[model samples]
Structure formats: C-alpha cells, structure tokens
Target: MAVEPLPEPLRPAGSGPAWRLRYLSTSWNGHPTVASGTITLPAGTPPAGGWQLVSFGPGFNGTPDRCAASQAGTPPFIRPLSEALLRAGYAVAVTDYEGIGTPGESSVVHGPAEAYAMVDIVRAARRLAPVSRRWAAAGYSLGGHAALWTGSLADGYAPSLRHVGTIAIAPTTQWGLQFAAAGNPAAPVNPAVPYQGRTLPVTHPGGFRAADWFTPAGLDLVDLAGHVCIEQMAAALTGLTMADVFTDPSAAMGEFTALFDPHEVPVRRYPRPVRLAHGTADQLPAVLTEITAGQLAAAGTDVIYTPVSGADHFTVAAAIAPQVVQWLEELFRRP
Candidate 1:
C-alpha cells in the first residue's frame, strides 16, 4: 500500500487543490488485502483544527479494479459535489471499494467489504495530510449502503477516529425487492414489448424489448457483470430484468441473501447523527427509505429522512449532495 500524488489528468481543475491517489493496506471479511482510493485535500485551509475528513463512497463503477472511480478520475457530476465539500473546509477520501483497481475479490454487494473500504481508506489518508479526528460518511445509490454501514461500525472499526454522522442518498435499502420485481411485468422498470406477436407472459422476466434494444446474441453477454465496467453491463440490460436471467429469484440470490438482507438493513448501534434521502420517483421501491429510516429511528438512532418529489435515482445524488455537505458542517460544529 503506497501513497502518491494524483497524476496530472486526475488532479482537480484550476489551481490550488492538492490531492493524492492511495493504495491501502486493509482487510476484507477478516483477510488482509490491498485497495485503491483518492484523497482530495481542501484548498486554502487553516481552521483551528485541520480539515475534517468527509469520507465518500461512490456508486457502482464496475467490479474490475481498473474501473475504480479513483482511476477514472473525478466524473463531471462528482466534481461539483467534491468542490462543495472542499469549500466547506473538508478533505475528501473516496474508496474505490475492495478489488476495484486492486488485487482482491470484490464483494461490493456484500455490505461489510464496501464498509471496510470506506473506513480503512480514512485511516490511510490521515497519514498523507492534515485531517481532523472528526469524519462524516456520505454516498449515493450502492455507495449509500456502504457509507451507512461504515458509520455504523466506525467506532469499533477505527476507534481512534471521531464518527460524526452518515448520509445515505437514494440507498439500496431492499435488495430482495429488486430481485422479485424482475418478473412482475405489470410495473416494468425497463421498457417491455410483445414477443413474436404475442403478449409476453408475466412470468417471463426477460419479456424482451425490440431487437434494437437487446438482440439474441446480446442476451448471452449479460453474464459479463464482474468482468467489465458497470456502464457496459447497464447498456446490455437496457430492456431486461433479473427474471430474464434468473427464473428463480430466491435460488438465484445464493450468496446475496447473506450479504444484503432486508432484515439486516442498517441500524445505528453507535450513536451519531444520520441523514437519509430518497427520490420520490426512484426506480428503487419508493417506500423503502421511509421504512428503513423508521427502522433506524426505532432502533434508537437519530435519523432525518427527506423525500424529494419527482427526482429519479440518478439525479437524486446531485440533488442531495449540497444538503449532505451542509449536514456534515453542522455535525462538525456541534459541541
């Protein structure tokens, strides 16, 4: 695990923002491993305490280490969010997650591995810059699940760091719902069409879209999930659902049940301020955040849930980033 300055292309635009790419010596599921990530230092800093670490976990980039967000460089949408945190006097550490851009198995759907990456990257980043003991976790989509889980275990995982709060934006709250919804043609998330001049059976999850959407040969390529980047896989699935591939939802999710169980949705065993947000029009079950947030509050965790009307899962991340940063600043100000 080594720390080095980011390459010229990877660095932030304009003058004055210093950043680095870090390969971390960390663990996943109790085994020693290495991971890669990016750490961006705030510009023109000098608070009474050093810059607060705002640990960010990005959504799916792909299973391959090369697709890691750190390696892809900061995407356009993410640049604004990162700048917001920087202007607020916060340092940002974004974990590529385990196995992405590093040598190791990627268990991204498995909560623990993603959580471990977010927390451990902070431990590695502290060595490279002036970071305060306080830290906050924030993420969107899949990373939302990772950020919350990290906040939940931060106290025990890295006892030296101060756990301030967590922000989960459009998180994947119920994985099972996604699997079951695959075959329900009544409410198709992906575009559906007639097959061979006959109405598609509700049971045929891959009810099928036009040839322009998913050709027969293209269907065979869906198996390439872990081998390529997320964008590619997403493109291949333009008109399909889990049912097209997995006829039996429960049986198909062999290891996933153990990893992303709704029954085991995050609970804040450790006390900290947490904020949860979801878009009203998100493809994810609309009621999920309300239910999950309620569960956290019932479990005695301080929770603030917001539902943004008309926002879809993709747009919700940008919609909520500034709000999350504001929450982090307020949490840091608290005595």
Candidate 2:
C-alpha cells in the first residue's frame, strides 16, 4: 500500500477541518491486502485529553468498486448521526471493507470481512492522527452488523485500543427468522431438505409454502448484487416476493447457514456496552433483538434494545441518531 498524506478526492471538507482519502495495508479474508477509506477530523480543537475516535461502518451500497461509500463520494456525513459525532469533537474513520473498492470479490455481507475493515481502518487512522485511546463504533444496516463485529473482534484484533461501546441501528440481527425462513414455512412446497440433495420442484406462493418464497425475479436480483450497488439491487428485488424466484424458496443456501448461527451473529460474545435501535415494522423483523439482547444481557453484556413501534428499517436510522450520539457522549466520558 502507498503510505502518504491524504489525497484530494477523499478530503471530507474543502480546507478548514481535515479529511483525507488514503489506502491502508491490511488482510482480507486472512491474506494481506490493500483497502481504502476516508478519515475526517472535527473542525474544532480537541479536548484536553485528545479527540475520541468513532470508526464508522457504512451500510451496504453494492459490491462494485465504485459502490464503496468512500469512493462513491459519500458526503461528509455518512449518516446524519455522524454529524453529531463530528460536532462533539470526535474523529471519524470510514472503511471500504477489503474488496468493495479494492481488488477482490465483494464478500457480500460476510461478518469477518466487515469486522476486519472496521478494525484495520482504526489502526490505519491512528498512524496519521493524534487520536485518543478511547473509541466506539456505530453503523446502520449492513454497517450495523460491521459495528457489532468490530466491537466483538476488537479484543482479539485490536486489543491495544480501548473500545467504549457500540451502536447498531436496524442491523441484520434477526438470524432465527432469516435462517429458518425456508426450512419452516406456513405452507410446505416440499420445504424439507432431505439427505439426498436434488432440485425438488419449482413452484409459487399459492398458500404459504416455502419452496416458492423467493421468486425467480428475486433470485435474479441476488445475482445482480454481485455486480451492482445497493439501491439498484433493492429497487429490483423489493416488491417481488421470495416465492417467485427459485425452485426452492429463498434457496436456503447451505452456505449461508453458518453466518446465521448464534455464534456467527454480532454482539453475542462481545463483552462491551451495546445500543441497538430497531423498528417494530422493519422488513428484517424486530424479534431478532429479542433473541440477541436477551442472550447478551444474560451473559453480562450491558445491552440496550429500543424498538420503534412503527418505524421501518431505513427510517429508523434518523429516528435514533440523537440518542445514539448521546450514548456515545456518556460512554466516552466515563472513567
């Protein structure tokens, strides 16, 4: 990786405050590689101790190189919530994961890839800035998953740094519903996965059968995600029900099962304070937090789960921005 001063395209602001685009040296899926990101420092002077760091993980946009948030010319505020962090005298570092903008297959929503991106960006930012040891993470949607993963892996990946807490808004947390969608459906379109693997039947959502949950149209969009950005993918797949797509509804990809496991979910074993903002009406299902928070609290993690009665998944990001910022303010000030 080319180590040097930040570049022009990455400059978060015109001149006053500081921001930079830089390439970092890190490992992707275990192999050392180069990744990219933007780091922005607040416009004002730091506190007596120093500026606290908030490494941000932006939600999934797409897998293509241009889809990387930093490369997409993402505005200074990745989220309105980030403006709050900057105003509060915190420095923000946003990573592009390893492949999204670099030389590799976009790992989709892989946990380890997002985690490494967040952790390594922090390490990279510290090299060029006067950052304090105290830090926390905040992300929404796919990025929310990354925030939790960052906190979970911080101890092992970047133990030298002190992590205050994590804030995840509408994160992909409902693993039980997500994992069991095809296996257990209201109606069975031959839902069972037998010992013998074969394409059983192609069907539709006549009743509530599972086999047709993913429509062919929907599956096509999944394939599109490999090469396009998030907005385009969502627009293509949003209204098409799962039943329309595949012979086996939702395709119960045997490959994705490991990620949906409790152990694979974020915040399960991470020992740190966590704040989750979920909307009851979210497309992903609010019940995911019920399972995650219950277990984390039981395991001695200080977890706060807030459900917005009628908020949708995307809208919930703006709804909880202030509270999440407040939470960070309180935590970073703690002894």
lDDT for each candidate structure? 0.68, 0.65
Candidate 1's C-alpha lDDT? 0.68
Write candidate 2's Cα lDDT for 1-21 as tens digits: 344444556554432244445
**lDDT, model 2:** 0.65
Q: lDDT tens digits, residues 1-335, model 1?
A: 57677777876554234555555544544777787888877667557677788888887766666678878877666667777777777888888877777775465555667788888888877777778888898887778888888878888888898889898888877666654554453333232111111111111225432232333443354325446675665666577654454344334343234334632456655478788999999877658888888889888888999998888876776677778777887888876
Candidate 1 residues lying further than 4 Å off, grouped into runs, are 12-17, 183-223, 241-243, 247-250, 253-259, 262-264
TM-scores, one per candidate = 0.83, 0.79
Q: Point to the candidate with the largest lDDT.
A: 1
Lowest summed-lDDT stretch of 10 residues in model 1? 194-203
